[model samples]
Target: MEKDLKEYITPPIMLIVVLLAISLMFIFPVLNMIILGAILAYGIRPIAFRIQSKLKFSSISILLAMIIVLIPLILLVAYISFIISGFLVGFFSSNPNLDMDSVISQLSTYIPQNPFLDKNSIVPTIQSAGKSVLTYLVGKLGSFANITLDLFILICSVYYFVKDGDNCYNFIKSFVPKEYNDFFERTVESVEDVLKSIFYGHFLTSVIIGIFGAIGYSLLGYPYGIFLGVITGILQLIPIFGPWPIYWALAIMDAIGGNYPRVIVVLLFGFFLSLIDMYIRPAISSHHADIHPLILLIGFLSGPLVYGIVGFIVGPLILGITYAILDSFRKELQESK
Candidate 1:
């Protein structure tokens, strides 16, 4: 045991370990971006290859692919921000003195009159809570430098990952024992499937649902219908939440206002949105492993806490890949036995 320790933890190994630890400390801050970049690279790689097949310039092909994938994402985020900012400005401007009484009175019939419930305080409480949330978001915007750095890292990481992802994979594979090579290959393949499953199944489904929502809401004559659809799409990305909240809120509000016809129409539209998700998600992910919704839920819920907004993507992917690795190991073990 002593000789094994001396051989394993030799001076050179110890030095490498110390340097690696310091390097990790530096990398820790931007780790989320790196992971996100890798995820994006996986999506972008096929496109890059297709472009490369035509253009025959690897670097240019990668840049074009990145542009194709990233531009829409940047635009979507910017549009969402613009819409939200406009909404806030309009809300504050139009309702300088928001009438809590009318809102409460409208809602009074639906809410059971409990002696302990303070009806008048409800709207104010909600307003205050909304303000706090706004403040938190604004505070997040204050970290411009960090956000910029992360963006830079993400772009660079994606570029390199697309350009040299195979090299990295082979480098890691080199460390695996010959006997376990098949296991390693299988695990990697499984991980790739998981990534594709989540991206296509969840993210794409959200986009489709969101678009449907925007069109339906706009035709239904709702204000900020596009914004509502965007929010509905984002909500669909999360497990245990779907497009229900948006329509339910709209339905309840319209019902309170005595627009019962429109309420029924919107509810039916919302149900259609939910029904499509049931179909779309499975159809897209059918070729891949059936990842449990619970795994995704925990990843979505906890990822933001650990890695910020990017965590929403990185968290679930990482967890899904981890699950793949574990399951792969289990299969390998069972086979050996």
Candidate 2:
């Protein structure tokens, strides 16, 4: 009896062990990149296929489609870098004093005169805190090499994912059961739709908002108005809180510079730009995919947490595919029962 029990349990335990070992070997890092690559490929493959049909050559079509997608992204990044460099140079070269001594003097005088007065020690503490913040910023900016390498890795990874996307998807899908091929195909379609909605919808909304923002800022005579507008539009891709911070920062800067009329104009411009999210995102996403906005919102919020920045695209595709597969399986189970 003991021997039989042992024999009965051994194979199943071994199987479990083997599966766990295999998963540990290939799962973590590759999983995120593979998922990201698959969604990107799925979105762009149709365009590549269309180009292929028109040009009657697969390689040329692939190349053209890739170039079309990559060129704008490259140009945008270059422009943003140029703007950032200029801003940094201007800021440091101005040599404007922050008036810390006057602030400390005011605090010391005002607090001592007030009924709430324990100002003796607080003044030194406040000065120390200010100096600590300055020291932190200086230390952070000193690590330029690390920052540059990280950025380079991000760009290269994105490029490689885009270039070899089809192969990546095919490799991952090979794991699905043969009997579940139909379900697998549908899941792939759903994932493709979700990714398309995210990528194209976000891109279209950003461009529209940027155009309106740039026009408004130019009219208001803001220096670097187009750059600020573009920055705001790009930041709109961040979920939960979008471009509000950028607009608010610009408004504050304008206010500090005594351009109150420009502040009002910028605020109104931002208000109009905010409406574009309502009009553009839903229009583009709904046209491509019939996904619930709540689901997309969940994807957008949870994505970065799970997969770093790439998760923003990967999260929704994963949720869509899981929903598709489970729905199909449930239907099948119901029919069988």
Candidate 3:
């Protein structure tokens, strides 16, 4: 009687303790940093294994994985920042010699008037909006210092996650009932497949669209084409808005410049890019994974609403893993039957 009581009481108590601890973990900002590390570790697993195979040193293998994964991201952001900085420097210049009124006067005739449109209204609004953005960015520079510290924490977490990940996995697995261990392992793998599918699938599509945007803009003789293209590419990952604004805005600018034919060409190019995202993304994503495209669409749409930028990843992951667990239960029921 005593042994049975202890057995029944211990599992529930431990489970409750774990759930409480996890709830507490969510209240800390460090959770986001840890999640970021887990994602990087998971995404770089293939590279990490290859490095391990060559070096036979777990620490070196993990370090190489970190560098391989992070350096490209750092370089891309740095390049984009440089481009944006140059654009801002030019935009906010208080050059007394430059004649804004004269420039506005020359371009105003080229703009076709509509029922709600005043010829001079749009350019001044644009100028004012640009100044407002510049002011906002100047105010946000201090927040960037805090972001730098978060980045450092993220890097350290990722390093440990990559190096100690397997050990951590084993430790967690040790907690599972021996009878359910195999099912738990399968569930874990299925969840991992979902994550990899989402990351690589969106990543590939974004890069392709970015290149297309850059090429299309360059052919159309648009200034800062590469910068706009990068922005479009980043936005492509978001489900609700994908390059529509960039292409449409550029098409309007072309129309304003009296280049109607070029406007049509820009629209067509943007349309093609959109179609690639709609069809090609799911094809690559579902190749090895069983997840529906709709799950991803919902994730991309809802994740940012709840978790800010990190929600983009965490939201879908939670949904996918939940599905996997349910499916595993179904499979076990069938087997028992």
Candidate 4:
């Protein structure tokens, strides 16, 4: 009777149970880090191997490789923080009160027929909101000690993962049933492709954008140009509307600073950089794997919603594996039929 009842259970129910069991076993705390580390290790493994071959020692090579990858990231964050702090200090110390009378005078002249000429109330509200935002930012930065510690932990985790990646990969591969080992191996390859393509491609593109932006902004003699450029490049990583916002922001800043020529120059440069994503990303990404652009788009959009920042890496990987597994199952079912 028990056997018959088990047989009667639906395939969907069985699949659900299997998924739950797998998640419970593999999606917990260390598993996520292990998986992340493995993917990272795969991307750097070739370089690590090259270094090892040349240096005749794996440990020193791995350490050097880690430094190569990590130091730039640390420097970028530190530089960005310094620039932001400098900007804030200058802005507050100046304490230049908004010249409402002058603004109203200009507005009255520009729009003679407009009835919304009262600037007193609106100006105060805008000033109040701006101050509030500045205060919030200061409060957040005041907790930098905790933020620094968190960053240290993340760096340590990534370092260890890079150091012990091969063993982790072998451990994961061992769990696959012998009959399905080939499929398991292919899945791992697919994951490596996805990780290398997404992580490295995104990193390279952001850096390029940031470099060009800083150069352009400096040429135009814009204050905090490098800082804004870094921000623009980071924003460009967003799936959609990334570059446009940065361009508009720079244009607005230029307008406020009464630098129309600089505004025009920045706008043109931003337009050029914005359009390069399509060509640049595809070129790098296609070299690794042939994931559908639409799937990648969805993963980029949904990743953060699901797994925070790490979701950007995890979401696409999960989707890729899902596609492979479903394809395999479909073929097997067809063969049985």
Residue pairs with backbone atoms closer than 3 Å in model 1 (clashes): none
- Provide the global lDDT of candidate 1 against the true structure: 0.91
Better of 1 and 4 by lDDT: 1
CA-RMSD of model 3? 5.2
Model 1 has a clash total of: 0
Residue lDDT tens for model 1, 1-337:
9998888888898999999999999999898889899999999999999999999999999999999998997998999999889988998799989776676657665666667667776667656777899999898799888789889999999999999999999999998999989999999999989988998889889999999999999999999889889999999998778999999999999999999999999999999999989999999998887798889999999999999888889888888999999999999999999
lDDT of 2 by residue, 143-260 (tens): 7875575555544444456556667668978977898777678666665665677677876787877777777777777778788778877777765666678678889988998989
132-219: candidate 4 lDDT, tens digit per residue: 9999889979989856765555556666666777677789788778987776776666666766676767767777887787777777
Error of 2 at 199 (Å): 2.3
Taking all chains together, each candidate's TM-score versus the true structure is 0.87, 0.68, 0.79, 0.70
Number of residue pairs clashing in candidate 4, backbone atoms closer than 3 angstroms, sequence gap of 3 or more or interchain: 0
Of the two candidates 1 and 2, the one with more favorable lDDT, higher being better, is 1
**lDDT leaderboard ranking:** 1, 3, 2, 4
Candidate 2 accuracy as lDDT = 0.72
Q: List lDDT for all candidates, in order.
A: 0.91, 0.72, 0.81, 0.72
Model 2 segments more than 4 A misplaced: 1-20, 23-27, 50-64, 96-181, 327-337
What's the candidate order when arranged by decreasing TM-score?
1, 3, 4, 2
- Candidate 4, overall lDDT? 0.72
